[model samples]
Target chain A: MTLAVLDGGTYYHQEAIYGERLGGRFDRTIYAPELTAADLAGCDALMVADRIHPGVLRGKRPILLDYLVGGGTLIVLGENSAQQWAPGVSWEFRPTNFWWWLEQGGDPGHRIVAPDHELFRHVGMKELVWHYHGLLTPPPGATSLVDITPDGDPQGKGGSILYDHCHVGGGAGRMIVTTLDPFYHHGSFFMPAASRFLGKLLDWTDEAFRTPG
Target chain B: MIDAILLDCEQSETGAQALITDLALGPRIDLVPFYDLERTVLSRTRALLLGLHSDQRYLASRRGQLEAFLGGGGTIVVCGHIGHPFLAELSPFQPIHGYRVDDLVVNREADHPVWAGVDPADLSKRRGVAGFYGRGSNPPPPGARIINSLGPSRCPVDFDCRPAVGGRLLVHAGADLWGYFGSGNSSERIMPQLFDWIAKPSEAA
Candidate 1:
């Protein structure tokens, strides 16, 4: 279950998250600009971390798509504009309500749509409650794991925050996309929830890769 | 001559991207990608704007070039927590603990053009929520003049340092100063005024 994370070499990515904090857990830190097909080879799970320049990854779309088609799990973090490069992914930008927590009895309105999913076993809804950048409308047959409703109503119209999609188009691989930017905040040493979520999420990614379904 | 060169990392935040777009509109500003810093000529550049998303490791590797630029009287503006050691003059960012809104309040330490039209209260909070301007301090080095402090404790949130013989540094322990844009307050004047201050080399403190 080799895990390879795309490193944009930002201070947050290189100094805080991958370089020091969670450096031991990752098998490879592939520099985003130097990413090639050979870099993805033998990698079971590849994570495109949040805030990586879209232009850097967009050029490697062919390499990434080929990895997915070749049965490699792909994890796309938030705020990376996946819609611009990812096939079948529809992304809509949302103004982040940074002050939502300041409101009386305020909640970010994040809901776990798939509580019974294995990913939930590692991370609960509370870990995903921080503000989000946007919503992802995953392709057909994709199972939405978490969502956020504007009205704070669990049954109200909402957008997916986390989703899982099996590559039914041409491969046995899968993709996990989330609008939550744990890496950015965690790496920046700002949000504690992001750190907790990242630790648990990494645990889940490691476990899921080991027990491939 | 270009007023400043911003190292653009293409950070995904809406506000950051908006700030970049706004800065791009400035006639004398050059927005270069962060990866190209090594090859980008900085001899004639007035200042280097390093954002929260800057690759500090890469900067550290090019410390010589940066020092040379600064030695030539270049001004470098850094925004965000200093997680890694890029310049010897900058220390790692220290986060404030058990902070309240009062602790996040930015106080002026001196009068300067950068802080001229900007209000301290407006920089403290945005729409009633505080801590947007800063969460910690970079801990200014010796001989550096503190421009702004946080709360009564006066933790240095903004300061000016002369790291090299003729270099100048404006370090802020928060997101880029341009993050103040669209706040609907006097704080909006910071980004433009900062560049104006830079353009006036005679005013270099």
Candidate 2:
């Protein structure tokens, strides 16, 4: 099973650095516009950064659907603005709670709602949040992982991180959508708090997304 | 009488378009896609705003057109990371990592009129979160002035420069400049201040 990260090459320097440190598991650091169905044939997991141009990706939707339905893993990262296309994803805008960590007796409203989730392994309160782009509402039946709870908010759910597993055309694949963009922030050395969590998530993607031969 | 034309990178101009309407500059400001920037159009164009998320390679390809726009007395407000080599008289980007909220302190040197009515604290903190001020910087070309800094040594976050031929570049090395989101602060004043300065950069001097 091979892993790859799709980039538009705008953040060239950061992309190179992130591609390097994840050991050798992530081999293909590809440009989004040039990505073809053939590229995903042998790939077990494909990660799409938020910076992609939606027009270039417009035609690639079916190719992506095929890959996921064929039991491959696809991860869509966070966007600072509106994102038009991504399979089974709908976004919601939530005012970011940057000061939750700074309040007196600070509650740090972000929490790991889905404790049983594997992505949270070894991850604690500090690593759970930095600044999220917004909230994501994954399609039905997907597991919601982390919630960026604004201070004292009831219901305790706003879906900051999500994992979707489903059957497509009698085959199954996994899709993970997160407001956290470890690839962007980690590469630039900004998300240091989540460094370990990010490392583990990458390892999990390479392992969990592998399809049987 | 278009004062500024923000080459809208749709993905990056979050809440900024709405801010433009609030300023009543919608009619006077041109919001077009990055691909729409061209010499033929820029001749009649005024100030063009390029965000960090705007396509750099695409803009870099139209290098001559950009220079000419400046020479024709147009202003370009590029808000975000400054790495495009095509932008004249600006140094390559200097990536600034691991900076805390306090690290994004505005310096006395950044007292340019562009920052008028803007607060350094507001620039540093949005909803109590810091560190979004800037993630990197570009070297100030000779005669360039620093108006805001990321850390010591004046690694600038906001700065402006005059190219030899013409035009001025007000580069804010951070998210799109606007204060219109739920949080109303000094950042909200940036768009208007920038519009004012772009309208008359000499007065800002």
Candidate 3:
């Protein structure tokens, strides 16, 4: 199987680390800036970061919708800093300046693990140690997954949202909006478990691979 | 027991949706739209999911009711961009905003119950959302033990603050939890952990 990761400047450490660890999972992993409708014509799956907004995505890249609607899988990571083209959502993302908060004693050290999630099954409890800025908005029609909690409280307001996977035209797409820094941060890429988790996600995307019994 | 999960409505549902699905929280998470907020924050509600907005008017209007709810031992989770503002008003600590320093770090509390079985060193190395647009003041509501803190400056990251009013407030500045779930890594593990945290057993009450 081959996969294309949408690359526009936004880089994720997890993606790279996963690629390195699970390089053999897919035949090829292509990183490109916006997969135009035509660009996706022959691709098996597309991994997108927070590059394509709702406006630019509308009809322009029918291939994406078509791919998902047709049983192909699409995974979206990161948040649009400007919230320009994201359809069915509204909110602005604040860049992490790391100045004032650092002086006030703000450090990013926390291991977020969803013990019951399927993606973590093979790896089982991966730890990430980097802080990435996130988006602020409720993604309509998307099912939320994972949340940042302080002292055992999950109701906290500022965290990421993973949305529902739906069939659009002829493919399937999953949208995830997060504040956790995946690529830019360094420590996140160093963990072996983290790499395994990424590999699992890539493998799951393939319809041929069934979860081991 | 509270009947519904009350969420402050302002920013769209991006953040909360993650908790709802990933963590399996809020079968009844209610969105209290800023425009529709009345004097009382619905007496029947059990918890409040607060989202920060640019408009202070909306916050001020609901402050009293929220205070009352907290005093009554209500559960509240504060998130979104205006995390600093909400913490300042609800807790003793005042949140300081703006950019500061580099090399963001998160130190873990060895003795904290939340850190039980979790390694402090491994936890410490984990970097939180950098370039926080918000900040908080005062020590985490008095007895609130600091779970995660800034590197040298000692700013709190993940902590539990208990108001004198008897309510529990959990504060987290990071906003990447939802994305981790959507990444489709360990859905089996992630979902259960999320639901377990969000919907603690009744004994927790």
- Which candidate number maximizes lDDT? 1
Over A122-141, each residue of candidate 3 has an lDDT whose tens digit, in order, gives: 42224332333453454545
Candidate models: Cα lDDT each: 0.80, 0.64, 0.43
**lDDT (0-100) at residue B100 of candidate 1?**
80
Candidate 3 structure quality by residue, lDDT tens digits, B1-205: 4433543332233455565543344454554544454544555665555543212334454566767877876666554323124434343323333324342344665344333444434333324444332233234555675666655666776666666665666655443333233433332243234334444523132
Q: What is the lDDT of candidate 3?
A: 0.43
Off by over 4 Å in 3: A1-213, B1-13, B21-23, B26-28, B39-41, B54-57, B80-103, B110-139, B174-205
DockQ preference between candidates 1 and 2, better one:
1
Best prediction by DockQ: 1
**Lowest summed lDDT over 10 consecutive residues: which window, candidate 1 chain A?**
A149-158
What is candidate 1's lDDT per residue for A1-213, written digit by digit as tens? 688898876656764444456666677888787898999888989989888877777888999889888998889998777888877788777767666677626666777888899998899866888878778776898988988876743335568889999873657878899888887787765677888888889889778764443
- Sort order, TM-score high to low: 1, 2, 3
Choose the strongest candidate by TM-score: 1
Say which docking band candidate 2 falls in: acceptable
Report chain A TM-scores, every model. Answer: 0.91, 0.78, 0.55
The value of fnat for model 2 is 0.15
Can you tell me the CAPRI class of model 3? incorrect
Ranking by lDDT: 1, 2, 3
